[model samples]
Target chain A: MGRIPWRLMFAHFRRNKLRAALTVGSVFMAVLIFGFLRTFIVGMETSLAECSANRIISASRLSLFAHMPKSLEPEITELAEGKAEITAFTWYGGIYIDSDPKHYWGRFGTHPESFKKVYGPDLILEEDAWQKWTDLRQGCIIGSDLANDENLKLGDRVHLTGNIFSGEVDLEVVGIYRSKVRSFDQKTLFFNWDYLNETSKAAGGRKDCVSTYCMLLKNAADSGPLSAKIDAAFENSPHRTMTQTERAFQAQFNSMWGNLPLFFGILGGVVLLACLMVTTNTMMLNARERIQETGVLKTLGFTKGTLLVLTLTESLLLCMFGGLLAMFIVQSVDGEILMFVIASVPPSTIWLGLGIATALGLVSGFFPARLVSRLEIVEALRRRA
Target chain B: MSDNALLRFQGVDKIYKRGDEELHVLAGLDMAVNAGEFLALMGPSGCGKSTILNLAGGLDTPDAGTVTFGGEDIGALSDAGRAGWRSRNVGFIFQAYNLIPVLTARQNVALPLLLTPLGSKARKEQAERALRIVGLGDRMEHYPNQLSGGQEQRVASARALATDPRLLLADEPTGDLDATSAKDILDLLQRLNRENGKTIVMVTHDPAAAERAHRTLKLDKGRLVHSTGAAH
Candidate 1:
């Protein structure tokens, strides 16, 4: 065996620039789609990983749309004492104060003290922000993203036209909170519960009706026993409830998308397989052109292993270039499109590009390397260039 | 011949099978070459001259009998064994010059030395020495595409001599060259045989090329029938 001539192998790729570029382009497209698909799944999971550990969501027995009676909040709080911290919130579905139709944010109505206790880790405060938030009666805490989008500062006043309550309410932005986790705190708008209860009572809507209660357990491990206790407490009540960890609660929202991860997985696989076929075809043509070169090397005393390694290295190198290109393109465009489509992109998607490129290298190179290794030196040399 | 015989072929045969049909190219061929001899093998096309060369160089195996080199039966060796032996003991010069297009003359010459256990520096030095022997010391850095056909053939000769092989096999080394380049290649082969004491087995159809050999053997249908010493 001879020393591997990497330069020699690389020269083959350099000579056919167009073919190499096309092969690499195919791989790039495949890996880019792979990255997109993977980012979607990770984005969904990240919403879970980023959810507040101190907050739990309690919903109906069958679905999130099932409501619970506001009377249960006291009993739930009594049972949660010492073992957990409890907060109650109802989805308000408030309309945006701005004229932009696309501007929508999650609005929740809750008791300020309990909400602060449950979300303390997630809150980002300005100077004297907590004092201002607790002192004002019409105070609201807005996500940093919402603040930026609507150009609202800490002292700014904003009005919401409630979709569910059907009235206009003015609230002062006393604080702006940003989540350390991805996209979690960026989309929520929090306001006082008294405003919501008063508006609903005046409108003769369901005043004692609440969508869910959020419980913060002392330990994450205690969630299983505590969830059972909460559910058992409401088992015979007029409106029975189901309590779950924040992760499972977020996952239930994912289930509404209906096997989306499996769909993306299948799409990623098909694109990669198509890319593999294109790569294999390109490599076969390249290998055919090098038949004479292979013979020359064999005649010069290069063994079968050397030829195989050289050919496969060439394929792998091409794929690596493609992978890098795909990563660059995905990193550049994914942020804007993801924020539009699914609200955020996850970092773990980078590995998807690398994995697809590696698999393409191996799968595409297999037949070409074997063909080069089995070529008869005499016959190969006799081949017309 | 007994004391100096570097290559010997005894009753060697090569048969190619295409489905049920058998094509016998070399039928029980017997030949021998001694050290320091320049032997020319001349024949018409399909006379099995190249087949004999392939057998002796360990590029192809004989179906029967034995092709031996320096007492080892090459026909009986495994593919890897044959490759190892060929790298250490045999150097080949093809009519096409066969220099790897991407590599410069120096790299092409150093190719055979790569099969040896020599380090990179040592391989370069040996390759330079071989190029100097072929009078192409200045052209070592030029790629095959940069050189003329004559220069490329000279580089091929340098590659053949790089590993200090005991036998040099040339298959129509002057076939693709002009008349002057062909003469220069023959002169190099003659010098390698006479001055360096390297065994040379060359196949050619040109009588002028054969005239440079110390002995000429004619093969007709795999049988060697006529031979003449250089003095004749």
Candidate 2:
């Protein structure tokens, strides 16, 4: 036929309503999940890409879990020779009333003044919030997302029971910070490192120790020499330190989740393949039902190519419609849905998901279209009759 | 025969295999259908009445010899080429009506016209004309399920006539219809032949339906065993 009648292709759906809906619904869920999971990997990648090159994080040489003595900061400061400003980070992994990951946020204890100065650009705060936290003994600044999730107002008390530092700690909220640079997470609560040491000393636990020392260099080029000097200074000490650029440091944290891009790629690929198989099965069922109709079309002078096009178009339409809907749904989704997993699905990921869906449609549609093309007209007509 | 024949089969053999055994559906069949003729093929079940129809329409190829239309060997054409040829020259009406349930009578009638160069408006107009010819003008907008058995068959007839094909093949067109509906279909077929000058080859076991044709041929085990002069 010159232009194959689209209605004929659409008729398969009209005749068997349930099968068509199910096929489209499967495609929708596949695209949605793929896009949703892809957001996490994309977010991690974005954060790693945005890390400041000028900063170096000094951590325990043994592992992320091992802590280095805070006294080592002065040795690193001397090695930098006034070329860098230093602050320390103590990861206070804590749980709010419940232990669910959704209710969790990064709790870091760092020198309030030095942390504020080092991360000046990343942390957006009110001018008075810093002065208030500076004056208050037990004050903390929380991320914008954490403030919103916990609905904590300024001067409101926030309590946490820590795993690393032990016992319970209560603090007043002094500020809420927002960050465009993702490495400085928006879901963290930064408190005075002295407060953590004091509490630990009071509880008879080890004090004046930190997870990482963050050194902000005056020149980004000095990162290499400064990092090497800092490592060598603590190499033989009981509290040995490993030092790297902030970018590499953030990358190491991301590596904790394995090869992120490959992990999500494989996860999404598996979902799409599973979707293709399901669509192929659905298409096969449709072809079986339309065997007689296709034979009649053949008898009416429809070529094998025309029949194949018809079948493929049906499959493509289902996937395209579902994928387009899923893409939009991912774009407009509320941040709370993936609160702990991902901040939001980026535009690039949405387009990528749609592309994957379209390819799945074309490849999946081919199997059944090939079957339709090879059907013997007489055999089909006879078989159906 | 060469001057007048629209379709010709010479020494044709068709065999179908069932696992290990071969069924010879047609054996050295020889026949010709002249232009402007109404020919009926009658036979018992499994007697190859429909096989000849299938061969005539280029739906299947013969194992030996040739089936030609207007002196062109259909078996020689590629599958796609034959489909084009069928679109241009052949129209078929089936016993079960075989109408796509979703399409209206006019749309079903316009199916073959999609292969032509006609614009959508022209195809629609031609489909309406065909429906009116089969006395179903009022039912043109109705779908197959919405119409009665006879009306559905009339829509099928309209479909067969829509392309203005040189040959029309009906495979027991009234097999599923009541006697009244069957007679109505036979009357419509007869009118198409005697008035419109369409060349039709209809397959049927109904002697009553066969009597409306200009001539009747009977097949037994794929061979022409009996023949009757023009019934009209």
User: Each candidate's interface RMSD, rounded to one decimal?
Assistant: 1.5, 1.2
TM-score of each: 0.77, 0.85
DockQ of each two-chain model: 0.42, 0.66
Q: Which runs in model 2 stand beyond 4 Å of their true positions?
A: A28-39, A61-63, A66-80, A94-100, A123-140, A144-176, A193-209, A220-238, A259-269, A329-352, B2-4, B15-24, B63-73, B102-106, B125-151
User: Looking at model 2 chain B, which ten-residue stretch has the lowest summed lDDT?
Assistant: B223-232
- Candidate of highest TM-score: 2
True contacts kept of 2: 0.86
- Candidate 2 iRMSD in angstroms: 1.2
Assess candidate 2 and give its lDDT. 0.85
- Model 1, A290: alpha-carbon shift in Å? 1.8
Error of 2 at B225 (Å): 2.7
State what share of the real interface contacts each candidate retains: 0.50, 0.86
RMSDs, each prediction?
A: 5.7, 3.9
TM-score of chain B of each: 0.96, 0.97
* Superposed Cα deviation of residue B114, candidate 2 (Å): 2.0
- The complex in candidate 2 yields a DockQ of 0.66
